[model samples]
Each structure stands twice: as structure tokens, then as C-alpha cells.
Target: MFLKPLLHDFRLALIQLHVSAVKSENLQRACGLVREASAKGAEVVALPECFNSPYGTQYFKEYAEKIPGESTQKLSEVAKECGIYLVGGSIPEEDGGKLYNTCAVFGPDGAMLAKHRKVHLFDINVPGKIQFRESETLSPGNSFSMFDTPYCKVGLGICYDIRFAEMAQVYGQKGCQLLIYPGAFNLTTGPAHWELLQRGRAVDNQVYIAAVSPARDEKASYVAWGHSTVVNP
Candidate 1:
């Protein structure tokens, strides 16, 4: 069932999510956006990274939830309601004693299709410039994720994964035509290479790349770069 070829046009909805400290509020906002996009004729709807929680390592453990938890459950139900494939942005997932940055994918039937844990952890520090460390609290995923859709094979990658060309090549070589990345690049790095990275990946792999990011909130302590856009194959 997963190996079949899909060759057709697909309308993708990139949910420019607005994240907050309030988990419930973020979920509600995302749901509304998903419904709105589905009504507009999108076959697939996606949310940004950390859509249900604030984008900070200090807050990850506090906001972490197990799979089938509140956020995933609501996203699944919404996907079923709208009858569209849903890429449930990245969420902080708690499994046993470890926590991971995970992205959940749901089919139109509302069943979970894939849970791609972010393989690359963002850990960069430039002293006075900017410093963020995900590896300090989050565990990295061990495998790549790809799934079939009505249009083609869709690949999954979280924020930092976009910087890796080999990762994109692996997916492209495996016959994926679209790469869906739920990312939240900070203002520092976003302005420098966000669009450049997306376009570069598409041109290199000859695949469509859509990057979904949370809307920038000035009041929030951690501001996300909210430039959610897609590039052609």
C-alpha cells in the first residue's frame, strides 16, 4: 500500500502557525487554519514546528506530550474532518525518559501514517551573536521518514535537517517529489539562509520543497521566523 506511485497535481496548504506558551490556544488556532485551508481546496495541510508549544529548550520538557496525546489527537480528528492529509508540525515528544522533536503525519482517514522524529538537533552558539542548543534536552531520531500520497512520495524533515544536503538527496533518490519541512528558524539565521536553503534543495534534488514556519510574535520571548513558503520542483 505504501509503495504505489502517485503522479498528479496536489494543492498544499502551508499553515503559518502562531505559537504561544498556551498549548490549547495554539492547537485551536492551528485547527482553525487547517479547516480554512481545506475548505479552500487543499489536499494537504501542514503546520509549523513547535506549533503547540513555545520554541525554547527550557520549555520543551514542560510542554512535551506522548504520542496520541492532546495535540496529535486533535490534529488527527481535524484531518479526518477535512478529509485531507495533515503534516502536524514538530512537537516535543516524551517517550520513556527521553524527549524528541517529532513530527506526526496523518492520512485522510485520520489514522497516523508516520511519526518522523527530527534526526538533526539544532545546536549552535556564536557567543555574542546567538546560541541555541536542542541536544541539551532533546534526543535525535535515528531514521528518515517518507510516505506516499495521491500526488507523490512525500518526505519529512524538521528545521535543522534542511541544512543537510545528503539527507535531501537520500529522499530524492528514493523517489520523493515533495519535501515537507516543519521548521522554526530564528531571526538571526532565517534572514541569512532560509529562502536560500529551500531553493537550493529544490534545485539540487529536482523536487518541490515547502517549509512551514510559525508566525513571528514580537511579544513572545522566542520569536520564530514566519516565512512559510514553497518552491517548485
Candidate 2:
């Protein structure tokens, strides 16, 4: 295991956000939550996957934004205002005419620390239950993302990427003390494997694992499992 003998302690906060179809409202709510978390002494705060817009292939093109676009601009401003590290969660990113599920991290001074495009595309057909394919509208990211903080080294991933244990092992080998995944697991797969996968990764890597998800929205087309959790090895 890659357990560290000693490391600086830091408080982490996960925002189980209620996502909406409205982009501006989503950003406002997320920023408010980050400020609240920072006020409560959280050194690092995370938002949920697809926190800025509704989670669906149909909405990808409508909500997709460039890296330095409006969504990321709000994230940077909030991080600097709160004086805390902020994980901007997964947004539909538009780069070179292709869309990707991406996560951006910012430091206390609001510098862009690292950006991770989700490596694994969630393409599962559970027959009678649910059928979804991200590849239809989104492209996969190729690189593993890691960044250094005063508290620890952080590794990033998104929703379906958590299922690959090998990715967690690589992060651990690279000395990542904490792994953060902003995910949006639907009702079908969430109850069965969400927490289980997080626990498995944390134990195997001997690192803190934070799996964040958007709050369950019953009225929406895609209902997410609302448990945003942190697991300790």
C-alpha cells in the first residue's frame, strides 16, 4: 500500500449539489456552497460531476464551454475569494470541436492547478435497467491528472473512471495521497457499486478517496445517486 507515515492534515468538503438545466443558476449555487464550506474550515472543497448543467448526452452541446470560459471563470473567482483549493467538478468541455467531461482544479490564489478530462467513457448497457453511451457526444481524455497542494498530492478522475482500479494504482505509485473523482452515477448503477468501488480503491491505494456526485433530482430525466462520500484507508 502507498500509505504515508505522516502528512499534513486538511479538511475536505463535498457538495452534494442539486443540478439544474440553467447554467447560470448552477454556477451561482456551486459558488455559494464553496464559500460556505470554506467558512466552515474546509481547506479543500469539491463540487459534483455535471454540477453546472443537466447530465445527458442531449445537453452536452448546449452546455459545453471552453476552458477559460464562464464556468471556469466563476470557479477561479470563488477559489480566490474563499482562499481555499477548489475542485470545479466535471463540466461538458468543448475543445477543438469535440466535447469532453472535464474537471478543473484551482489553488487558493485562483491559479489553474490542473485539468483532467475523463479518460474512461461510461458506456454500459445493463439490458433491462438502463442504456447510456457518452461516446455518442463526448470524446475521452488521454492523460492522468495530478497536482500538488500544500496539504497533499491530489489525483483526479471522473464518474466512470473510478471503476478502473489500475488508474488508482498509478496515482498511488506516483505518490498521490488523495484521489478525487467527481462522478454522476445513475439510479441503476449507483446503489450497487458507488460506495463499494470507492472503498475498494481507497483500501488498495492506501489513500483518501473522495467520490462526489450531484444530488438526486427526481424531476430530471437522469436521476443521480445523491451520496457524495469520502473514504479513508
Candidate 3:
């Protein structure tokens, strides 16, 4: 009798978390979401950018923490307990007095798989509407990053980073089957460009793209257009 190769199916949970000024509440909410996803048999859970804090650059100084800080520590523990891969969304990280918008990925074993900082900062200043200067508060990530999972090779990209095609092309060249982007785009661009850019990247790279955004916070300092979605190439 001949034996056949075995194949496995992978399930991903995209968490569109609503961010707030309270850190403890945000973390608790994320942990809860991870637990829920795990209960649903999700092998991997991807979260929205800045899931532990607000999205604006102005709040970077106040919320930034180190890699092994409280947020990552809590997320790692949750991943270990739930036995699911957790993409601990983007957060403000403090390094040598400079801040970085970074994403940390944890394995089911509660190990730090990979970390990718936002390279392409949002430095656009739209006249009479919105102005963003990420460089002013956060240092840009110098290198591209990807990690291996039981399901497939995964690539990481943040909000503004998705607009750059080079990053996705690099991931495609590396044989990544899925690219995850945790973003919180503003109304000025989110309404018109969010989905378009995500789909474009997915089609161009021929890979699945999962983009999660924080639910709209109209009363916050910056309002985000919430429409978290997943796209397949």
C-alpha cells in the first residue's frame, strides 16, 4: 500500500480592536480577543495596528515601551496559554530615546518569532485637511522582516508601509504565501485608498493579504475609518 502526503488547513483570526487611551484596558481586550479566536480553532490571530494604544504620532512619547515590556510580555503569555500564534499588532516602542512603531509576533510556544518596525513612515501633509509626520516621533525601521509558521510563510507590514510596493515584492520573492498588515488609516485616505491599496498589493504579489484596522474612534484626537478586511490574490 502506498502512503499519501499529508496536508493541513490553516485558520487566521483578524482582530479589529478598538484602541483607547487606557493601556490596561486595551491589553485586556486584546487578550480576550486572542482567547476567543483560539476557542474558534484559529491557528493564528492577527490584530490591528496600535491595538494597545492610540494611532496618532502625538501620543508616541507617552505610550512607547521596550520590546520586552509589559505589552509583549502579556501577549506572549496569552499565546502560550492559548496555543495559537499571535501577531501582537503594532505598538510604540522606545529605543535609545527614539520611538519606533513596531510589530511583534509570538509563536504558540510563547517565543518571539519576529519583529518589524514601520519603515515607510506617514510623512504626508495634506493641505487644509490632515498632516502627519511619523518621522517627528518615531524612527523608521531599516529592514524588512518575515517569519515562518505552521500554516505558511508570513510577511509583516504596517499602515503606511503597505503603500510601498517594494516591500510586498520582496516578500513575494521570498515565497511568502500570506502578507499581514495591521493598519489604522485616517478618514482622509481610508475611505478612498485603504481597500484599493490592500487589494492592489495582494494582486501584485499574488499572496493573501489580511489588513485589520481599529474601529472608528470619532471622538478621539484622530478619527479612523474602520473597515477591516481580508483580500486574496
Candidate 4:
């Protein structure tokens, strides 16, 4: 069980940008936020889930970008320019006719550090309240991802992955002090279980947890609850 102490100088920033149907604009908006975070003394800047496209699975197909592709290329440059570790939130990934919700982590030199394909897909139906099934379009990732940093090893997961404690525990057991999950929790469940689960994992594992969610946009097809949160244990 590796729960190392965090670096004293570590300052992480969570970017909460409103995503839209426009991909180019969305990327640019994220870039601007990255600069803002860097200027504010954030050594590691993280974005919210589905930062480049709409939160719905229907939009995933249209907006899905290939890994090591355009979205990544730009993110690499941004990380290099800012000289900071960058957590790319989650992007719809298109690989071999299969789509996955994936998040990419970039090193300070702009090199790809690690990529985590969401192992758990968000599939929930609240009857007339809310119904979303990511499994309809996204294939669950089979592996766990953890990357080393000057501060500590960071475990990566996407939205629904938060519901699972085993995954986070494995990361901590293997020597991870920080866990980050880029997510989009809806209005229905976000209010109820979002923070509860975050705090639960942190308290149980004695690790720092950060979960970033897209900014609330009621105008969009799927409205996100819009509370990007953090818990320290």
C-alpha cells in the first residue's frame, strides 16, 4: 500500500469550462483556461470530463477524436508551453471503429504520460427523471492507469468510475497519493452522491481526490450538475 506524502509545492488547478457543440471553440476555450490556471500558480492543470464535446453519447460519435490525433497534439503543445502537467479531462476517442471515453495526461515537457480509457460506462435510468447509457456507444476500458510525477503517482479514471472503490484502492496500494476522475454527473445524481462518494474514497484510502465536471449548461441536451470538487484525506 503506497500512500506517499504529497509534494509540498504541488498546486493543482481544476478547469471548469462550459462545453458546446463547437469543437474548435471548445479547444480554444480550454487553452485559455489552461493559461489562466498556469498564471494563477497551478503547476498541474486539469480539465473537466467531456471538455471538448457535448456530454451525451449521441454527440460522442460526431466529436470523437483519434488519440495522438488533433486534440492530443494541441494539448501536448499547451502543456509544453506552460511547463506544467496537464490532465486533459475526457474526450470521445475513436479507435478501430470502437468509441471510448478517454482522458490523456501530459508531462511538463509535452510528452504523453498516461492515458486512461474509462473502465466504467455511465448507464443509469431514473425513469422520467434522467436516462443515460454510455455503454450503448462506449466500450469499457479493461486496464488501470497510473502515472508518476514529481509530486506523486496519480491514478486516472472517468466519471462513472468513481462509483467503484476497488479501482482507487488498487492505485493507492500500488503507490498513488492522488486520484483524479474527470466526470459529468447529471443534475439528478450529482446533487445526491457526487461529493459523498468523493469524500468516501478519500477517507477510506487516505488519499487526495479530485473530480472535475463540465460547467452547467441548461441549454445543452444533457445538463451537467456542474460541481467540480476535491477532497483530502
The better candidate by lDDT, 2 or 4, is 2
TM-score of each: 0.96, 0.98, 0.95, 0.97
Q: Residue-wise lDDT of candidate 4 within 20-69, one digit each (tens)?
A: 88899999999999988999999989999999889887899999989998
Q: Candidate 3: how many backbone clashes?
A: 0
Ordered from best to worst lDDT, the candidate numbers read 2, 1, 4, 3
Q: Which is better, 1 or 2, measured by lDDT?
A: 2
Candidate 2 stretches with Cα past 4 Å from truth are none
Q: Write the per-residue lDDT of candidate 2 for residues 1-233, one digit (tens) a residue.
A: 44794367889999999998889999999999999999999999999999999999999999999998999999999999999999989999999999999999999999999999999999989989889899999999999999898888999999899999999999999999899999999899999999999999999989999999999989998899878999999
lDDT of each: 0.92, 0.94, 0.88, 0.91
**Reference-based lDDT, residue 152, model 3:** 81
Candidate 3 — what's its lDDT?
Answer: 0.88
Instruction: Tell me how far the alpha carbon of residue 13 in candidate 2 is from the true structure, in angstroms, after superposition.
Output: 0.4
The 10 consecutive residues of candidate 1 with the worst lDDT sum are 1-10
- The residue pairs found clashing in candidate 1 are none
- Is candidate 2 or 3 superior in TM-score? 2
Q: How much RMSD separates candidate 1 from the native structure?
A: 2.9
The full ranking of all candidates by TM-score, starting with the best, is: 2, 4, 1, 3
